[model samples]
Target: MSKQAATLEADPQLHEVFWIMAHEPALGDNLARIRVSKGLTQEDLEERSGVSVSTIRKLEQNDRKSARVSTLRRLAQALDVRTSDLFQPSPEPVSPLDESVHTDLFALRRTLKPVRGLSGIHMPDFDGEVTYESVRTSFLAANALYREDDYRAVVQTIPTLLLEAMTLVAEAGSPDSDRAARTLLSQTFQFSAQALIQLQQYDLAYQAITEGIANAELADDPLLGAWHVFNECWLFLREGRLEDSRRAALTTAETIEPRFSTGNPAEFATWGWLLLWASAAAVRNNQGDQAEDMLALAEAGAHRIQGQELEAPPFWAARGASTFAGFSPELIQIKAVEYAVVQGNTARALEIQDTIHLSGKLSSSTRHRHMLDVASAHASEHNTAESWAILRDLRTRVPHWLRYQSFARRVVDQLIEDRSRALRADQAEIATFLGIES
Candidate 1:
């Protein structure tokens, strides 16, 4: 057998180096292997991925245990394969749970790539009569469910809703009706995309968003286009295209700025929310100065929108959605704190946390998101007690909120791995919640 095939036959867990590379040796090996297979030298990788020759060498030599997921993605794209293909297990047999997760991911990629360049969701035919208002209302309901952290509930609701929206799109006769149908259809697909991402179905999530983007463009709604880009930033971040995500965030925020004005609260909220998204992308990109600058700009916009009579985007009247609301200031701070935690600025994160108003400054989902960031900040500082305390509080208060959130899960995993003690109680709590353990 070939080396990769031999390794796989010997031990399915003999990973090549996947997204989260906790094991250095396997990562280095896979990096070198993929490089050779692509007929690229370290210099070629450095030139193509902009990762630097020394850094590439360090990764291949196992001198560096981890690089940003974005860096890996750049290399993978240059190498011409899915990013997951580079993952190499640590020569250990895969666990049943890991196997199951991978199996599902494999199946998801298979099911979604039904055809080539363009995509559409395969929803069953809607037998009932469909109207724009009804489809819009159901989209709003799905948004409400999403903000409430009921992801699976949203997933269950969307397939039929998608069909109904698609049906409406087909049957609309007038220009106004056509616009309404297309926007609702676009928004519904966006919802489907977000739900799938939350559930960690990345490939499928991407396909859904691709369809959403196409529909958004067809609808020709600036706000829908902004929302589409916002979600695209999230997908790019997850897939480690940090630069593209950052660029999209910055550019798209600017793209929708002209739509905002003092007279229109929806447009105002939409622009400010896009700024917040730009800040989010900057933070993920580790551009501390740029992140701060973006947040400052977003805060200024938020100040303008806060006291005005708040209005949501008519098309996406999802409760507690960042875009539709009249700019939640605390929402921006929550993301900043989350970014700070990731950057290992525990003290700074804590200081920002103090400024966030606990008494409804944010939605329930957002407040909990901030709290999750606090827990992660503590965990990053190796303050096990504080981290677990925040986690436990979340489990008690907003029990379902963190369960499906990928960021929350990643933080929990980091906390468990970084903890000094072997007690692993927090680990057990998260494992139980994830159904990975009793």
Candidate 2:
């Protein structure tokens, strides 16, 4: 099936299965065995399950660690077994859920205890102590790391943590774990939101932020509610929904006042982040006067909370800096390129791009995205030679299914379709980039 059709027809269940297989390395191997025994090729399973072939490959390679639960149930049905059968890891731990829960909890505790002890702080008493709150804390920790651009350290582990939290919540009969699970789910939403944004999947990012808000409400977490609004507004800003973004930010600030204002450092810090984000939106929309006012508010808020640090929240680090500290160099470069395009200044855009260095610290995935952006900006100016050259360089480092591939291809295809003089002038370079005839 075409990629678009496959996405539209994707089975949520199989997606969950792949999610599971991705998390549980042993389970993935087991599933692979089952598939082979059933005489199914990767393509066959992709057709049957509506999971992309690439995901199937990741599972069989034992490269991914967790998947969505909905996917597991579907895979079980496809394999003709109960969901329980999929988690038969050897050297059985107390319970699959507990094992999953404990792994995350231990890692978080290890990271936090030293900080707590050094500060001579007393930890809060657990109310129900069903491991719910502890798991929620773990999600927060992961979020901090994610926000710091430390994607490689936690990306493999977050999916499992989220899946485990979801499972626990689903099985809870009372309202006991509901709040904690919801909090954790909000973190999951944030993680997914950031990932989607990185991929430039704006619609999906909006969906994630919306879900995060729902989870925050369920958890009765006002701070998360504020965060949800802030991020949702951010999505709007990125998509040029400027008015909507401004309204959302203002509404969030109104709701978070006095209470959230005097709360934890993180809470106060979030207020700063929101104001900054909202200000940026205003600037984008040409609300120049409003933009300056909002930016002043953001600066004042950030200044108020400066140097106040906690153990740090998950995903908040990367997000925190970007939000309160102002735009990352990455996003700034993108905007510069965009502005150059708008002013019909292709040469300036290219010049600006040359100075916009890719972070040596960025992950392979992030680096690929940066290069694609550069290529795209060049393509926008009909610099076919330069665009094609950049795309060719990128193709060597990125995979076939990387999201940016579509963007780069769209540019090239449009150029070919136009059949302008530029196309003839750079046909060889274009052909080389497209791997076609000149």
lDDT of each: 0.62, 0.52
Checking candidate 1 for backbone clashes, the offending pairs are 14-89, 15-88, 15-89, 16-87, 16-88, 16-89, 17-87, 17-88, 18-87, 70-240
Best by TM-score: 1
lDDT string for model 2 (134-173, tens) is 6666666776655444433454455555555655566566
lDDT of 1 by residue, 292-371 (tens): 88778777677667777765556563532543552657666766676666555678998888887765434555566667
Give per-residue lDDT, candidate 1, residue 348: 94
Task: Give residue 180's error in model 1 in angstroms.
Answer: 1.5
Say which candidate scores most in lDDT. Answer: 1
lDDT score, residue 183, model 2?
Answer: 68
Error of 2 at 192 (Å): 4.7
> In model 2, which runs have C-alpha deviations exceeding 4 angstroms?
1-163, 166-182, 192-208, 214-227, 234-242, 250-312, 315-334, 342-345, 358-370, 380-382, 404-406, 414-438
What C-alpha RMSD separates each model from the true structure?
A: 8.8, 17.6
